[model samples]
Every structure is written in C-alpha cells, then in structure tokens.
Target: MVLKNILHHRFFENFLKYRYLLTELVKRDIKVRYRRSVLGIFWSFLEPLLFMIVLTIIFSTLFSRSIENYPVFLLSGRLVFMYFSQSTNGAMRSIKMNSPILKKLYVPKYIYTIALTLSALVTFLLSLIVLVMVMLATGAPFTPYIALFIVPTVLLTVFNIGVGLILATINVFFRDMEHLYGVFLTLLMYSSAIFFPPDVIPVDFQWILTWNPVYAMISLTRDLFLYGQMFDTFTLIFATISAIASLVIGLVLFYKYQDKFILHV
Candidate 1:
C-alpha cells in the first residue's frame, strides 16, 4: 500500500499538478539546444538528412546491392536511435546541469529528465519527416501498416524516458557516468544493426540482436516503413514488456534517490 501510494503520488498526482512546469521545461530545453545557432531549428531537419546521406554513401558502396532501399532502411533506424541516444545523454546531465535552479526551487526532480526526453522527442519527430521523404524518394512501399508506427514509437518513447530517469538519477551520484555513457552509446549504435542487416550476423550469435530492445524497435520501424509487413508479435510483446519494466524500475529509483540528489549535485 505504501508503494502503491507513492506510485500514484509521484507518477500521477505530481505529473498532473505540474504539467505546466513540465511543458515550460521542455520548451526551455528545446530553445537552449538551438540557442545562438544560426541554423536554429533547421538543424533538427538537417542532422538526420546529413547523417542519412553520409551513411548511405558509405554503406551503400559496401552493401548497396545487398540491401535494397538502403537509405530508407538506414534512416528509419538511425533517426530513432539518435533520439534515444540524445535524450538519455541529455537527461543524464539534466539534474546536475540544473542544480542551481533545483537548489532554489521545490520542483519535482523528475521534471528535468522528462523535459530533456520530450525535447529530444520533438527533434525526433521533426527529423521523421526526412525519413518519410527518404522512403518516398527511394520508392519504398508504404501500406496501412504505416499507421501502426505509433505502436513502436510509443514503446520507444516510454523506453527512452525510463532510461533517461535512471541515468539522471545515477549521474547525480556518479559524475563520471556521463563520460562512460558516451562510450557505451557509441558501441550501442554499431551493435544495433543500424548500418547493417541482421542476416549478415552469424546465425549462432543472432540472439544478441534478438534480445536487444533497440534492435527490436529498429526492426519494427523497418517493417512498418520499408517492408510494409506485420511486425513480429514476439518482438513487439517483449519490447512493450521491457519498456514498462524499465519505466517502473526507473521511477522507483528516482523516487527513492531524489531527496539526496541536491547534496550530490
């Protein structure tokens, strides 16, 4: 009953009461991200476009014939992965970075992490336009299945928020976590099958991809956009469960540790 009440208070009541603060924080983060940059918001559209172009050139030369519609395949996965990477990295520093404001105010601590995640989500949605254009330009077939992209997208968002919360909480205690996570994200990016197809991976070692949540999301995105095929039911179920579990764990950790964050920060 204690745990249930805590969950309701932190996850439901606080969120509803502070919804405006969350929105303002999210807006502040978005503005801070593009502040003083001449390109400003256009960078959101450009980053993914440029990344797709560069990777398409490099990977296509190597695997072009092997992978049909390589641009669509790459962009679909890359865009989502970029959002996850950026959101988590930003959230990891959200608490420490905002320590001044946190020190002065009584705001709920999770606001910083959630705001950072939403800011990244906004950028991810903007870049998705480029992904759709790449699909159309590459002549990838789109079906009504495309409408269901929301399923994986929602799952991925929840996963990112959970991961962000945990990272934010940890980084408050461990200053070195930021540098360590940067290296980890680089390794995760390559291992996620963003630049390569899973078939090329050894059958014996395929479970690595099979168990990876990020890869599951990428595969689902590819199926929805490029292949116009139904997503694997098992993968979908596993990803949803994994996302929910992460969110619950993250919330508990953050709730437990939030009071101590100011001292560490």
Candidate 2:
C-alpha cells in the first residue's frame, strides 16, 4: 500500500524535477565549501596533495622494499577510496544539515540526499583532475583502456548512493551515527588497500579484504590506472548487487522514518 502511494505520488511522477533540484543543492554545497576562505577552491587541492606527499615520504623511506612507486600506488587507491568516503560521509549528515530547507519546504525530502551526493560528486571530479596531472607528471603508464573505467565509476556511484541513502535515514534517529562513522570509515580505508598492497595483509584474513566490495571498487580503479584491462568480473557483479540492495534499503528506511525526523531533530 505504501508502495502504491510512492508510485502514484506527484513527486515520483516528476522525478526529473527533483533531480534538477538535487543539482542546485549540489551547487550550493560546492560554493559553501569555499565561502570565505582566501584560497577558496584551492583549499580542495591541499588535502589530497598533502595526503599524497605525506604517504609518499613514509612509504618510500620505511617500506621501500615492499612497495614500488608508493606515491602512484597510493594515489590510485586513495582517489577511489576518497570518492566513496566523501559520498557516504557527506550524505550521513545531509538531512540534519539541511534543516532549514526541510522546515520551510514540504518537498519529498529525498531531494536532500540526492543533493549531497551531487555535492560530493563535484569534489570527486575536481580531485580526479589533480590525480590525472600527478599520474602524467610521474610517468605513470597512459593507456586507451583507461576510458573503460567509466563502467565501474558509474557502479561506484550507485553503490555509494545506496549506502548513503541508508545511513542518512538512520542518522535522523541516532545522531551518534555521525560520530561513529569516522571510526568505521577509518577502518574501511585500511581494508580497501589504500595504504598497502593486499598481499601484505595476512593470508588468513585476505578473504576479508578480497571479498569486500570496497576492495573490488579500489581494484577496478587500480586496473584502470596501472593496467590496461578489466578486472575481477565476478567480484564486480557481486558488488553491483550489493550497491542496488543498499539503495532499496536506504530509500525504504528514509520513507519509513520521514515522520520521525521532524520530531527527533
């Protein structure tokens, strides 16, 4: 019955309109990120740059024998990991952050989720440019196969959207989700092989990393950058299912908790 209303609702019918609003919200988020800073958009350049420099120094000096070209290696994994993290982390607090809009507008509310995702996507593009520049300067292999990365890139977007949707809905009731997310995401970064090669992780625990969807997502990006071939098709398919499931759950939970947000927040 609830599904019937969702199907029949005018907002559902006019999804393109909602999607356009999401674009505007994304734009607002991008501008607000740099509002008063003297450096403005340049600040976005600092984070990934510093991260690459710090890690490059640490890995090159400490683990020189184990990993080669750690700068390029980590950059490949970190960029993809950063996108997934940014999308989910931004989305978790999206509902609360947009309180003014929620209070004033009787909009379908899912618009906020879409908006936050779009905002993260803006940064994702900006960061990718810097990543490409570093790759070319460092003499990382350039290949025609890099173009094929669009498939998994799109897949990652859907996967994150599903997970982000679910988390944002729950956050309305349990504000602690936001605080706890940092810890979860930190551990997630390690598990995704952003810092070290998967080989270094213990053999017994290797499946934990190999089976993880985040790991596969990172692997896809690495293949696009390092090798000129598609990778791990079975894992990719499984991850796609996981992503779709996440979205369905997130949407359902959001709709279920829609009434409680006004009371709780």
Candidate 2 similarity to native, TM-score: 0.90
Q: Name the 10 consecutive residues with the lowest summed lDDT in model 2.
A: 60-69
For all predicted structures, in order, the TM-scores are 0.95, 0.90
RMSD of each: 2.0, 2.9
**What tens digits encode model 2's per-residue C-alpha lDDT throughout 112-207?**
876777677777778777778778877887788788777777878888887888888888889999889999999888788787878888999998
C-alpha displacement of 244 in model 1, angstroms? 0.6
- On TM-score, the leading prediction is 1
Best by lDDT: 1
List the candidate 2 regions with Cα displacement exceeding 4 Å.
1-12, 61-68
lDDT at position 243, candidate 2 = 75
